[model samples]
Target: MFVAEAAGLDAIAATGTLRVPRTIAHGISGEQGYLVLEYLELGSRGKADLLGERLAALHRCTADQFGFAGDNFIGTTLQPNARTNDWVGFWRRHRLGFQLRLAARNGYGGRLQSLGEQLLGALPAFFAGYSPQPSLLHGDLWSGNHGFLADGTPAIFDPAAYYGDRECDLAMTELFGGFPESFYAAYRAIWPLDPGYATRRDLYNLYHILNHANLFSGGYTTQAEQMMQKLLIAHS
Candidate 1:
């Protein structure tokens, strides 16, 4: 896990789009894997607009295919990052499908699995005309993952980095409490999202909530089910 995190930090740092804590070192100490990162004094508030613009710039970094060189973790859950040419197939097979299968393994079945299958089948409808370039992503981007350096520069950390649809990052920013309005406005100002993004946002976010359900089975399972049902209805 430490090694994967170092790789992810390196991937994000390579883009030169945003500031990431430098991965000083990573290795196993005895039976425990350890990662050392450069410390940055972080504050909750900073340049929200700049954060948005730089994040958009980060999204501009793209790959020929979706996924990363290796798999990583999303909050302790193993996240697969097998490269593929098809974005929809990647999401279905690795993101949502993987989580749903894990959920089933963890004994969450019946309605949840049923809705998940339906949502998986209807995935293509959401991307009928949209073919997304595999842009660099901060895979587990949530409000808690970002902050400002003491210099007022926006810095992001704890990445589950991969190359996928840029909107995946944007969708995650909106998942919890959300970033400031300036962040969204600035991002759109630089690279306006597709007209179909509103409908697909929930689809992208479903992967995370499902991950949450798999990681901590309680209200998140219901949330995932509700999200799946809504997605199925939206695209059906």
Candidate 2:
């Protein structure tokens, strides 16, 4: 976990688009593992607009394929990042399909699996003309994962870094509540989202919701099912 985390932090920092706590070192000590990082005093009162602009810049960092050098975790669950040139296939196999299989193994089946399979089959329709470059992503981006340093520079941390659709990062930001309105506006000012983004946002965010359901095993299951049903209906 610590090793993957250090790699992820280094990946984001390499972009130089936004601030991340510098990764100092990571290794196992005795029975425990540790990742040492340069500390920063974070605060919510920092510039939301700046956060948005910088985040947009971060999304500009791109790659040829959709994945990372290796797998990592999304809050403890192993997140597979096998590189692929096909974005839709990558999401279906690595992101959504992987989670659904895990959910079944954890005894969440029946309606959930039925709906998830349908959604997976329908995934191609969501991409239509939208071929996305594999942008560097803060794969676990949510409101809690971002804040500002004492100097008011926007800083994002605890990344599940990968090369995927930039919309994955943007979608996750809106999943758990959301960032401020200024954040969205500023981001659009830098690089406007696709016209189909409203629909695909849910599709991208489903990955995280499914991850949450797998990790916590509570209302998130019902939540993920509802989200899948809603998505199927919308696409249908």
lDDT of 2 by residue, 18-84 (tens): 9999999888889999889999899888899999999888889888888998899999999999999
Candidates' C-alpha lDDT:
0.92, 0.91
What would the TM-scores of all predictions be?
0.98, 0.98
Looking at candidate 2, the ten consecutive residues that score lowest on lDDT are 143-152
Query: Model 1 off-target regions past 4 Å?
Result: none
For model 1, name the residue pairs that clash: none
- After superposition on all C-alphas, the RMSD of every candidate to the true structure, in Å, is 0.7, 0.8
Residue 116 deviation, candidate 1, in Å?
Answer: 0.9
Q: In model 2, what is the error at residue 11, expressed in angstroms?
A: 0.9
**Number of colliding residue pairs in each model:** 0, 0
Model 2 TM-score? 0.98
Error of 1 at 201 (Å): 0.9
